[model samples]
Target: MDNAVRNRAWRMRRKPAGLVQQDDLELVTEAVRALAPGEVLLRLVHVSLDPGQQVYMQSTQELPGGTIWPGDVIRAWGVGEVVESRSDRFPVGSHARDHHGVAGVQEYAILPEAALILVDPEAAPLNAHLNILGMPGLTAHAGLSQIGCLQPGETVVVSGASGAVGAAAGQIARIRGCRVVGLAGGPEKCAHLTGELGFDAALDYRSGRLAADLTLACPDGIDVYFDNTGGEILDICLGQMARKGRIVFCGAIAAYGSGDSRGLTNYLRILTHQVRFEAFAYYDYEPHFASALAELAGWMQAGLLKHREDVAVGLENFVPVFHHLFTSGISGKLVLQVRDGVTR
Candidate 1:
């Protein structure tokens, strides 16, 4: 352990413009420092690429400086193994999922023991902790149970339905006896939603027939709308809400990179339909994590829940792979494989 290890990390090169570009991030290598008390050095195995990270980069409300500047290590969620540890909480050889600020696009990281969520490699594959059994899965549970107030036999439409959170939400709603319909970008993802995920129907938003397709799919009108993309798609769904319907504002990926902040035009429908709208964040339901995890795991093991991962290899490819999330058509969860030997 006397030799210093070279740690490679991706840092913001400049503030991103419209969509995240390849040059927006640069890979930098540095020698690892000695771990202090209560510190653990991790070898990152998998990293999650979420649309919310784009909003984090552009948001000025949360950061002290009002901007994520150059040379800053981009924040993300990563699953890694503790190669070295000085704390009993995160002993050496333990697998863990790191918290937001401590985890990033890096090959290795030195994080405090308190920031790690100890994971059992035997429970499920390591990558599953980043997908259906992780943040996105918890997000789906919180939105539906706490906010959406979903009822059996209701018609539910999930925007970005092929993405991680949306996919989980759709399947969970189906398990709750709701008629689940998903709206994805392409036909392939739409097909996967209906054929593989047991959704009642799937709509391709890119088909230019969203309104007609939605009407045909939900003849009774949508009782619950799990909105992942908030833009024109939201407007379309808003106009189709049933009386006393509920809307879960999970994300606004449509407006993340773009500077457009236009208000919803069809918002008056909420008042007319007596609709209830609630915004959800997974952290709010931390107390219920164990129950949610158990239920999702049981469903997964019973073959009732299914998920997919679009994995990109190597830390050097992090920037472009992240950019692919917004532009390229990807189904299910988007993950980056920083190191080898991690299971699916």
Candidate 2:
């Protein structure tokens, strides 16, 4: 290790308005200080990009660990290699991930063992630790199994089905023998969902015929709705829900960028049908993470689950790649590769 290693990071400069503008965050470089006892210095390979990042950029967003503010390192999760370690749990050269802190989105991160999740480099690609075998997959499992009470042969509808969490949710539902329907933005993403990911049907939300199309795709009505995008799509799903249906509210991408979530007018459907509506934060299911990870990893290794990543190289690409989340019709998990050739 070099005596003087420079660390590059993106810091939130101000609370963003509507879409996150380039000026909202500033890139800064400083020397990495020596690690303290029980700490590990990580060379971050890939930073996970999520829609929740948009909410974190706002000053008003309430967070358990507090919100990201001006001059604070933008919060993210990532997988990396321990380059230098002062902890027994994280030896040098071991792979680890920081899913509990704002230490990501930088070329290097110094974190304590308690904040790191030791990962198996041989189980899957290093970036997979940030995707399928990590938060997204875990979120999908928790939402469907714990909250949705998903049963075999049921009808499942996943909005934002091309996204990391939704894609996993749809596939997991399918693995349980459900009739899975996906809603994405474009034709290609829809095709990828049904053709590649084994969804029964996929619809483009941008199309003018969502209501009719959804009815056609799910004639029996949705038994479990894995909602990632809130707003009109949510309202449409609410209207078509079966009696005693379960809704797993995982994200609100439709409203995160603009901070203007549309209120549902069809909420009476909840009362009339005696349906259950539940929203969850990822960490709320931490106690069950180990079992969830094991099951998801097994499915992935057996080819029952598939994952995709739209990765951009360099920490400098962080801002633009994040911007693409709302503007560009990019599919799959979005990631920023801070260090090259660390996929192992």
Number of the top candidate by TM-score? 2
How many residue pairs in model 2 have overlapping backbones?
0
RMSD of each: 2.4, 1.8
lDDT of 2 by residue, 1-344 (tens): 34388999999888887678879888999889888899999988888988888787774757864588888888889788899999999999899998675566888889988888898888788878778888899999999999999889999999999989998999999999999999999899999998889999999999989999999999988899999998999999999999999999988888887767779999999999988999998888889988999899899989999999888787887877788888645777888888665554
Candidate 2 stretches greater than 4 Å from native: 1-3, 340-344
TM-score of each: 0.93, 0.96
Candidate 2 overall lDDT versus native: 0.87
TM-score for candidate 1, residues paired by index: 0.93
Give the Cα error of residue 272 in candidate 2, in Å.
Answer: 0.7
**Cα lDDT of model 1 by residue, 152-261, tens digit:** 99999999898899999999999999999999988888889999999999999989989999999988899999999998999899999999999999988888887766
Report residue 338 deviation for candidate 2 (angstroms). 0.9
Candidate 1, run of 10 with poorest lDDT: 59-68
